[model samples]
Every structure is written in structure tokens, then in C-alpha cells.
Target: MRGIPLQKTLWHLGVLWRKSPLALSPEARTGLWKMSAPASTFDIFLSHTWHTPGKWKILSLFFQSGWRFSFLGWFVGASLMLLASTHKLLPLFIPYRSNFDGATISCGAASRCLLGSLLGHGLGLLLSPYAPSACARRPLCFLDVASIHQTDRELMERGIYSIGGFLHVSKELQVLWSAPYLSRLWCIFELAAYRTANPSGRVVLSPLFVECGACICILGAYFAAFLFVFALPLQHFGIYVVYVVGLLPIYVLMHLLRRNILAKHQLFEGLRFFTLAEARCESDFDHDFIHTAIRAWYGSAEAFTAYVQGSLRQELLASKPTTIPLRYLVLLVGVPFGLSLDFLAALIAREAPMEWLLTEFLAGCLGFNLCWFFGSVQIALFLCDRFAAPWRGGLFDYLQTLVLFLIFFGVYFLGSLMASTSNLWHALAVASASLLFAIVTLVCRRAAVGS
Candidate 1:
């Protein structure tokens, strides 16, 4: 009885279980969570030194074993999108390059919106398990209630991340922006409503605000760069005149600003060392979600820093397995480079005088960005962190990754089903179809971990 899992012993076996170190204390179990990670995600941290050494050995083994899945997932997703576009029956989502939906403007709003969310949510899911925080561990309580006191930002900076805290708000902004301009006014009310229901006092938001602002500013610059692409259809002299006057100068201004903020990813990792090294009792100061969220924003730079500083940390991780250098080499080459190629091709094509056939391609990319802005996979974020324990154990966990693949495939599936049936004026389903992926992403949290 002492060793049995709580659920199995209490409900299924109809017996009382005894105390075990691995069992989750009622404190961690308390709260509104429906789907939960295996208690082990937390339990390992609490283990005493005598048993920690073996656990550390097992972790390195696990990291080595799981590298394939990350690589394979990336390839499969890219290939699926490729086949979906090439096969005629499937709907191809092309981006539009029009500076204005109706009339010319100075920037590519849709692309900016897409990139904002892409960076925010994209990195969250991609790096979750291997990173210090799991995507699922969203909520943190203030003062521990037992300890009985703390301030708002103080509480926030502790690690009680709401599933939506890190990336959801910005993605939601995408939804707000995707709306018709008039509809955009309603977003303030939407924020007020969300805060009212979600409880701003209990939740944290520092990094979220900072990250969202950084994303807006950074992508805002990238959007400005596309202006050079937008005026391409004009006479060469006219385009050059516009590029010099309206585009190139502005883009340079923006890029320099973003380059400054992004350049220092390595410097921020030191905060983690200081915090971990300094932590003591359940003192309320160190565990703020707002602080942690802000800290999480640096991705590769942070990883690079951590790799460089190995063995010197104030608090060394029990399982500090080194990642294979090739994995990161793949990323440094793959992500931003691949995205840049797509961006350059679009930028060049948009600048080139229009070929009618190519018009649809640009049109599709713009449309996808609009769809992407409002769409989120926070639930996927939840599952990635939520069921992480059950994940390594067996069938149910594997099914979860399948959930993302299903939605990934379904976007093309539903779009193909609807788009092939009619003409653009009548049968165009890509907007709603892309949204279907977003909705599936929303629902899958419940399917696996519930939103």
C-alpha cells in the first residue's frame, strides 16, 4: 500500500496507500489542475543526496536516447507542409505581398504579426522539456498561503507560470490584430475581460509584457524591411526613389535596435546562476513567475551561455547532461537560416514586377500570418510540460505528440477538402482552414491536458 500510485491504490484497488517519498505531497497536488504531469517532474528535485547520484546517471542516458525524436519531428513537420502544397488536391497557403489589403502602406503588418507570435510560441514548445521549466507548470500560488504574505510582482516573479503566461498573450494580440481594424478596438475590452476572469493578482506578467514588446518592436522593423519589396512593381526609378525615401532608411533604423536587444542572450543566463545559487528556504523572494518568464526569453544565447559555464554554477543540476553539439549546430543553421531564405525569396519576388501566377504565393504567406497571429498551441504547451512524466512511461504520452501531427496534417487536410470544391470567390477556405489548426491546437490541450 505504501508503494502504490495514489490513484491506483485509492480508487482501483480500493486500499489506503502509505507514505512514500515519490508520492506527490498534497501541496503540489492542490489547485485547479485537471491533467497533471507525473509527480516525478517535481519529485526528483526534492530527493535527498543519497539517491540523487543514480537519478543523475539515468538523466544523461535519457537525453542521449531522445535526441532522435526532436530531429525527426522537425523533418516530418516540414515535409508534411511541402507535400500539402505540391499535391493539387490539398490547399496551398500562399503569402500575399501587398503592402495594403486595399491601398499601399509602409509595412507588412501581417508578417510582423506572424513573426511576433512565431517567436513567442515557437520557441516555447521547441525548447520546453530540455529547458529548466516545463511548458505545463503554469500556475504558482502566492506566499504559499501557509507562509502568509507576498507582494504582486514578488509573487509573479516566483515560478507559478500560467499555461498562457509566457506566450499566450502575444499570440492573442495576433488574433486581435488579425481582426478588421474596427474590430481591433475591442481588444482592450478582451484584455480587461481576460484579466477579470483569469485573476491578474494571482498571475504574473513581467516577461510576457517585455517579450511581447520586444517582439512587436523587432518584427516591426522586419516588417519595415518588406517595404523595399512592396514597391518593386513600380518603375525602377520610382521603386528606388520609394525604397530610399520610405523603406531602406527605416529598416536600417529598426534592425539596429533589434540587433541590440537580441545580441545579449548570453549575458542573461547569469541571472539563473545567481538565483539558483542563492536560493534557500521556501522564502518567497526567489520563485517569481514574472522574473522567470522574462529570464526564459533568451533562447540560443542562453543555451550557449549555459554550455560555456558548465560546472561553475552556484547550484548544479543533478542531471546536467551536455547536449550533443550537432543538435545546436543544426539549429544555428536550420531555423533562422531557413526562415531567412523564405523571407528573402519573398522579398525578392515581391520586389520583382508581378507575374500573375506568383501573386497567389505572396498572397498565401500573408494570409497564413494573419491566421497565425490569433492562433495558439498553449494547450500543446500544457501537454509538453503537463504529461512529461507519463510521457516517458508509455502509449498515452506518445499519443500526445501525435496530436500535434494530426492538427498539422489536418490544416492541409481540411483546406484541401474545402478549397478544391470551388473557386476563390466562393470556395476559399484557407482563412477558416488555417484557423481550424489553431482551434485544434486549442482543443488538443483538453484532448491531452485540457486548456
Candidate 2:
């Protein structure tokens, strides 16, 4: 709404009020800064694990002091967190550990009561280089730093420069590592927002924040409401813990692997007929024979029909072959991650007292799965538009993503009716993941056509 001069003035005003943030009083600052957009991905990310820096010194001290548990804590915690943030949802499992009381948890390992805490700790470590410790102390301020790089030097030179000092040397790692860390940071921020704000808080937390909070709240309420809810007749506490802890790593690894690695690639090249190759195919067969060979490759009636139909459409214009970008991975991973986190937060909170019947717990789990599936669809849509075409990938396509929802419901309906509800929506969600892959294919193919 404001012109350059006005925006410049806002920046200047922000500079004048930078260090002594609480001085302006919260309301007036929020009111003035409302002119800016909400926190960007970067903002959320930094907040997620900003605590590591402060803890970093303490953690480093542990190592220096040669504490056995501290070393084990950092090592195991970092590895697990690296694994967990990628995949949020986990399957149920039972484990046996010599030290642990009963069956231990594992997505595939022993239960970690310290899983989230250690995750938070490890995340804090991974994030320590890019995220300043001071920021953790004043997390809400990230909303103001949404996209700021304006005072980087000043922040490091004068402000509590714990992480920033390291960042001075390795800007790339500092910048690159920020993504996943930022997300975790945002989760913490949401957690803080939930704690700090009133029940009637008008700020309106995003759906995940709202869902997670509500789920956590409802979960506790359910234990109080139903006598049988937490009065487990056939206890599977160990199995339950394993299931939950196992989930956290799956969440983390999925993001790291999918977003950081698998989802990114360079463009693929080469198309026949469209561009003449200097070297031609060395087949010495006749044109008719070659035609026969080509037909046989796509011999299926459906394949032939699709090929014919696709060939005729002017809309199917070819461009340069492109690779899926990290952004797509972010969508593929981030969307599902947020949704599943919401679901898990709900599920855990619900089962806290451990009294619910197995049947009800199962149903609750399934329903929450459905919720995550929907939320992920939103993320998938965002990725589609973000990677391929911004306009085409809008609310409409995202809304249309219900094809996936229906697909899962169809599977779940068929599955849960049988002996086990385990594979019920699982297949559909997997299929949807494939569908997302296909969308990526369509996008990259489109990019290829354009190029």
C-alpha cells in the first residue's frame, strides 16, 4: 500500500527500534508491522531450532567435560532428528531393550522419551550456525525479520552473535541449512504462540497450529471425559511409545532426503523428430520395419491410444526436458510433514493417559490420517504451482486435489472393512505421493516442451 519513500521510512523506523524491541510495547509494534506480510518460510525456519546456540555452548561443554551421556545424547539425538523431521507419521511397533522397562519404540528402533526433546536439541545444534541464540529468547520477533538481511553485520557484530559468528565464515551452509531448521523453528514459534496467546487469541494460528493445539487439548480432555479412555485393560504402552518416537524420525528424514536430495536434479535432454540429431539411429532396418518396432514398444491398446491422442493435441507442445527442483521436494515433504505433525500432535495428546479402547484409538488414528492427507494435498498444490506454473497451480488445482482424498477414502473404506485397517488409507496416500510425482513429471515435461 505504501510507496518507496514510505516503505523506506518503515525500514528506517525498524532500524531505530531494533535492539530495544520491548520498549515500543507489543501492540503498537504489531499494529505498525502488520503492513508487512506474515513470516516467510525463512522466518519460521530460524525460529524452529534457534535454541541450539545457547545449548550449543552447554552441549560443547558436555563434550569438553567428557560426559558419557552428553556425547551419547548429542550423537544419537542429531542422527535421530536428522531422520525424524523428514517423515512425521510412523507405523506401530514393539521393541525390547535391556535397560528399558518394557517393549521399546522404534519406527524401526527403541523408544525415545527424549525423542522430541533430543530432536529439539539436535535441531538446535544443526541450526546453531545460522540461527542466533538471542532469537530463540525473542522468537516472536521473527515475524518482523520475515525476509530481512538488512542488518546481518550489525546483528553479528553487536547483537548476541552466537550462531551468527560462525555464519560469518560459511555463508552457504548457514543459508542452505536454514530451510529445515526454519520449519522446526516455526513449529516452536507456533508452540510459543499457543502458550502466550489467550484462548480467544484473534491472531488465528494457521490451520496446523490450530489443529495441533486443538488436538493436544482434545487429547487431554478425552482422558478426563471418558473413564475408559486412559484405563487401558490391555496395555501396549511400550508399543505405543515406539510408534510415536519412530514417527518423528520418519518425518525428519523424509524432508531431508526428499527435499534436500531426491527432489532435486538437472534437466534431462534429447527428443526425436523435434530436433534433428547430428548422429542418427544406427538401425539398418526398413522404414516399415522401424514403424513396426515403434508400434510394438507401445503395443498395448491403451498406450497406443494415449500416444495418438497426445500427439494430436497442440496443447502438448514440447519444450526442454527439466528436472524436479528442491522446491517441489519442499512441497512433497513439507506439506505432508506439517499435516502429519498436526495429526500426530492430536493423536498423542488424545492417547496421553493411555486408557482408550484399541478400536477407538485405531479409528482416531485413521481419522487424523485423513486430516493429514488433506493438509498435505494443500502442500502438494502449493508445490505444483510453485515449481511448474504459478497461476495454473492455484486454489482450483489444490481443491481438485480431492481426487487423492477420494482415492484414499475408497481404499480406506475397502481396507478397514477387512481384518486390518493398517493398509486402509496407506495405499491411497502412497498412490497420492505417486500422483504428486506424476504432477512433477507433467511439470518438468511442460518445462521441457517450453524449452
Candidate 3:
């Protein structure tokens, strides 16, 4: 096989992000290529569709690049929120009972508390910064838009033909997937070539919609936390009042949750049914080239198709039902956990006895925050496997919505009941049971995935 020519350059991922492919000056490109270490090999083969919006691509890349840091940032922010609230450094804006007597915080104060938490989160992210120097040390990627010649036809053809060589040398393939990605002939070629070239190499399937869904889920969690803070003071006014007040936000959250799950289902279905024949190419010459390459690599087009439809399908579905990373889950769970710190601060400000504080701690930390929030998310995702079918958009959809809402409501009610009880033994029992439930659910899911 003809290898990638020395003139074909690998781009620094940071440089590519900074001076985007569309606007790279010749001198800058030459400088970046010179800056790249081990010019013959690539760290990543970026498989993406040119048709995807640049903004979406950038966002996807952002998440891909700094996901670890993002998780750490969230953790730090949550910790800081708790620390500040415990020390009474930040004002207690969320209401809490004073010796089981009801007292409400002003709405303005609550809004400020929310705003402070957001700012703290943003600050935390900034603190866990990705320095330019650090980014420069990241993988050297073969991004076609930058790596391949765009304006020069001869060089472009050579680069296109040399993609197989690129894949052979690259360590991993990172697919910046969108709805149109699978349907693109070039995208399919890249995927097939990379897998064929390096069977043991990592192929990260990052659906663009996953990040969008994660953001929506995070926002929904924050909204739920906000409502929980509001409902805390109202618990003294009968649990029914709290439930009635929460219905609207609960409905909103359910809608968002269902929408996210459905989007994931659509993506999964697309992957399951993907076929090379259905993929489109802009040029007949390119199509022929890809076909010839696949035939050469895999013996025949039919064999390559089988590999994608069989092995690739199984690999993708292995993490099915929910492909969300654990880090994102931590971030999701952190929102409620962090917000619950306000309740702690409120108790401290009220000078509650140590026993009462200890009960609140166990109830909030173990019972409500960890057990309720984490377990509930897992249950929703697990249930999505069964419920995420074709949307009939009638009574069925409403029924699905109701089912989801009730599941969430039931989980919330259990956690609330645990928190409301003043008995330490009750809190401990609820916490232990909740923890056991979470552990069992996780173990079963892993077993199912393994099977």
C-alpha cells in the first residue's frame, strides 16, 4: 500500500481548534506541521462528516477533549458549594425548618443562591483549565478538512487515496457522529478503513446529540434541585402541598427526559440498520475508489458490509440503552448533591442540635442525594430500553409520559419521606435500603450488558 507521503501533514489538535481548517494561513499551516512531533504517525484519525455544522463539531470536540477535566470541575464546584454553605460564608437563601417550624426564604434570595452556584460552577471549570500548552500535548489528529488539501485537486486526490495509510498508522478513530454521518459515503469509508486497518484500535462513537441530551439532563437536574429547595420549607404544610407545587416542574422534567431518551433511540436504530449501499457519495470517482479499497482490504464489498452490520453493530449495542459516560452521570448527580448543601447551611444557621444535623446529613447525602438522584437516573435509563420504540403520538405517548413521571415521583416521594422522618434509625434504614437498591440495579445492568 502507498503510504501517506511526507508532504501530507498531521495537524496539532489544539492548532486545528484555534486556527480552524477553513481559515488556516499557509504560513500558519506550515508552522503547525513543523511543530507536530513524530510526523509519520497519527494519534487520532478524526472521522466526521463535512456536512455537520462547524459549531456542532467544535462542541463535540470540546467535550471529547476535556471530559475528564469537566467532571473534575463539577466535583470541585460541588465541594466548594458545600464548604462555603457549611461555614456560612455564603448566605442561606433556600428555606429550611427552624426546630420543625416553617420559615421561607425570599424568592430573590433563592435566585441569588442559584446564580452563585452557577458562577461557582463556571469558576470551577475555569480553574480546571486546559492550558494551550497542555492542549498542544494532546493527540495529533488527521482531520480531513485540515490534513487533506482542500483547494489543490491533485494533492486532494492523493490525500483522499492515502486515507487508508493514515488509518493504518493512527492509534484510534474518533467519530464525531451526527444524523447525517452514517449516510455519508466518505464517513462510512473512513469507519470501514480504520476498523479494517486496526482491529484492536479504539473507535470512539460520539454522537453529537449525546452532548445535547446531557446538557438538557443537567439543566433538568438543576431545575429539580431548585424545586426541591422550594419544597423543603413547604414540607411542614403537608406533603400534598409540596406534591401539588412540584407537579408543573415534574411535568417539564419528564418531557425533557422522554425527549432525550427518544433521541437516543433514534440514534441507536440508525446505527443498527446502517448499510454501505445506502450511503451517498458526491462523486462517482470517489465511490469507485472506496469500493475498490474495501474490496482490496476485506476481499469483497459484501464482506465489509457484513463486518459493519454484524461485529460493529454488536460493539455499539454493547453499551446500549444508554451510552452516557460515568463522568456525565457524576455531573448529573452532583447538581442535586451540591444544592442539598443549602439545606445543611440553613440548618446550621438555625443552630439545630447535633443529632438533628446528623440525621439531616444522612438523609440528604445518602437517602436523597446519592440514592434518590443516582438511582432514579439509572432507572429512567434502564426503562428507556423498553419504552423507546416508535412514538405513536397519541394516548400511548401520554401514557408513556405518565409512567415516567410516576416513576420519578415515586422515587422523589420515597426520598422525601426518608428526609422528613426525624428518627435516626429510620434514616439509616432508608439509606441502607436505597444504597442496596442502587447496588443491585447497577450489578444487574452490568450483567445484562455482559450477557
Candidate 4:
């Protein structure tokens, strides 16, 4: 079997991140294939589509492989937040003119200052403790574009015919699913062949939309941070205006969530009604070859189709729904949590009074930033489940979007109110309530999964 190192595969794919496999020159692809190590078995068989953007495949792989990229993301985000807090980078250009109770308050600058110092402390804590490394051995993956021949027709045909051999040897089949994956003949053939060859091997479905949803959550968090840093200075105009401005990010998030929901619905529906006859291939010769192979292996095309419709459908559906996994959630929550560190840093930097520190740390950082943002993501996940149902119509989707916006706005409004208050008890109350809501939503989701 032709196998490429995980690191090299990522490098080559990164080079072609914006382009499809067709964009690679035949000579370059042939060279990549030749450079691959010859192995009797592969650790992973990567099944993907050429039609989808390459970046999606890369992101899916990173998400599936491990937490290396996630940790890197947190490190980079925390570093940036620290810099912004210290005014070493990303200075708020907006003039601060808000004055309350005989004191001029530069909320924007103060927020940044606090964010930077808190990140600094966090970095210290992260480094000061000695923790064992959690890295795992990287798997050798058989990627079609690199493993199969691209230039010579004879070699290409041989490679295509030998795909079953590779799949048989692979311990795991990783399907990087996109919208077009189910309708493609070759994708279905690969999936069916792998299952037939290794009945006990793992089939890991890493849908592209789930990654997109996680990305949307992270982006929304950053957008919220932007509004907090810039809009807080506008409190002189009225807090309600800041709330209105906050709607922009929430609206964008809802729009993306709608797309994610549609994709997820299509995915499950496709699995339910998969038909080999309807699957398309670019070449009739390739189609005939696959059909012949299937008949030879399973005695008839109908039997193979039954296998796909019965066993494969159940297996794929048995995996988790479109809800973002816990790891991705951690990555998502880290965004605002990292930003909230600024509040702590600011408190320490100015040597503020104990009551001020308590208010900002408890109310601003934990309650408003961490707990409120966590609740917002839970709401998004819940809305995703609601809209994904087939019974929902376009009109209802629009109404739900509106409802989601209002719900997010209300949460933000309440968080802002609590964070602005000087009472530590109010901060504790808001934090407790939001945390409880997040936990309850999570529990209900788990129960739904169980049932």
C-alpha cells in the first residue's frame, strides 16, 4: 500500500489549500506518489472529494487527529489578547469620553490593559507547571491524490483497481464528508469496498459542516470581544446602542447556523436514501470497472446496494449528531475566556481597590464573558437541532433566526448589566445562573443522544 507521512500530507495539502487536486500538475502528483513510503498496511485511509475546497479537508483532518492545532490556536489567541491588554498591540483608536460620578472611565483602554495582564499571568501558570506531553503517534494515511497515479493511464488504472487492497490494509477509514460526497460514485464505492473488506475496522465520519459551525462560534466570540473593546467607550451615547451594535455578530452567526443546519439535514437525508444507480462518475470506464468489482465481490449489485443502505446507513447515523464535540467546544470557549483574562490583568496592573477587583474579576470576566458566552453557544447548538428537523419550513427558519437574535441580545444585555454593577453578589448570581443554564442544556443534549 502507498502511504504518506501525516506531516508531509499536511504540508502538500497546505500547499494546495485553495485549489483542488485537478489543479496539481500531473508530474507533481506523480512525484508525490513516488515519494510515498511503501507499507504493507496503512494506519488511515482518507476518503474525500475533489469537488470541495481543500481547506475543508485539512481542517477536518486537524480536528480528527488531535489537539495540537487547538492548543496552538489557544496559545496564539492568548498571546494576542495579552498584547492587546498591555497596549503593545491592537490599541483601541476610539477616543474615550465617558465620565460617571466625577470619574473619567476609559473602558476600552482599561479592558485591553486588563486582558493583556491576565494573559501574562495565565502564560506564567501554564509554563510554570510541569505537565507530561499528551502527543500521540501520527498515523500514516493513504490519500487518493497522492497515493494514486495521475499521469500515466496504465499506472492510474492499476492504482484505481488496487484501491480495495489499500482499504483492506488500513486500520481506519476516515471519510471527510462534504455535501457532494454521497452523490459521487467513487466515494460510495470506496466506502462500500472498505466496509466489505474489513467488517470490524473503524469508519470515522468527520463532516465538514461541524468544523464550520465550530469556526462560526469562535468568530462570534472574537466579534463579541471587538464590540466589548470598542463599543464600551460608546456608553456615553447609551448602552442600548451598544446592544444594537451587538446584533450584527449575532445575525451573522444565525445566518451561518442556518447554512450549517441545512447541510446537516441534507447529510442525514442522503444517508437514508442512498442509491448506487443514482451515484455519478466522470468516466463510464471507471463506473464499469467499479460495478464489475462489486459484482465479483458481492455476487450482485443489488446485494452491495443493500449493504450500503442497511449496515452503512446505521453505522454512520450511529455517530454523534451535528452538535460540536467537547474538544471543539473547549476551543470555542477558550476565545472569550482568554479575552476575559484582560479584566484580571487590568485590575492587577492598576492595583485597584479590592471591591473593584472583585467586581471586574467575578462579574466582568467569569459572569459576563465566560458564562454568558458559554450560554450563547449552547443556544446556538439548541437552535441548530431545532431547525435541522425536516418539518421546519422556510418561514419558521426565518422566525427562529429572529428569535435567536433576540435571545442572544437579551443574554448580552443581562450580562452587560451584571458586569456594570459594582456588587459582587450580582456578578456571582449572573455567573451561577448562566453556568446552570449551560449545564442543563448540556445534560438535555446528552439525554437526547442517549434516547
**Candidate number of the best TM-score:** 4
lDDT of 4 by residue, 124-237 (tens): 323321222344466778887777777887977888889888898899998888999988889988987897898889998878888778767766766677676666555566
Comparing 1 and 2 on lDDT, the stronger one: 1
TM per candidate comes to 0.24, 0.22, 0.80, 0.83
Candidates ranked, most accurate by TM-score first:
4, 3, 1, 2
Record all residue pairs in model 3 with backbone atoms less than 3 Å apart, i.e. clashing: none
lDDT comparison, 2 vs 3, better candidate: 3
TM-score-better candidate, 3 vs 4: 4
**Cα RMSD (Å) per model?**
22.7, 22.8, 5.4, 5.1
Ranking by lDDT: 4, 3, 1, 2
Candidate 2 residue-wise lDDT, 1-451, digit = tens: 1101111222322342234233555554444444434331121212223322322222222222222232334445534543453243433232211111232222222123224323433343334323334433212223222223223445322422222221222111101111122223223223222322322222211111111222222222222212221222225786466545543443333222222221112111111122111212224342234334334545643443344234412211231112222322221222222222322333343332233223223333333233333333334323432343222444544333333334433543343343122342443454444445446545654554355
User: Clash number for every model?
Assistant: 24, 43, 0, 6
All candidates' lDDT scores?
Answer: 0.31, 0.30, 0.65, 0.68
lDDT of model 4, residue 29: 66
Candidate 1: residue 18 lDDT (0-100): 23
Error of 2 at 369 (Å): 16
For TM-score, candidate 2 versus 4, the one ahead is 4
Alpha-carbon deviation at 439 in model 1, angstroms: 41
Regions of model 3 farther than 4 Å from truth: 1-38, 54-59, 98-117, 120-129, 132-137, 230-253, 263-268, 319-322, 448-451
Error of 2 at 216 (Å): 17
Model 1 over residues 313-354: C-alpha lDDT tens digits? 222222111111233223222232223324324434344334
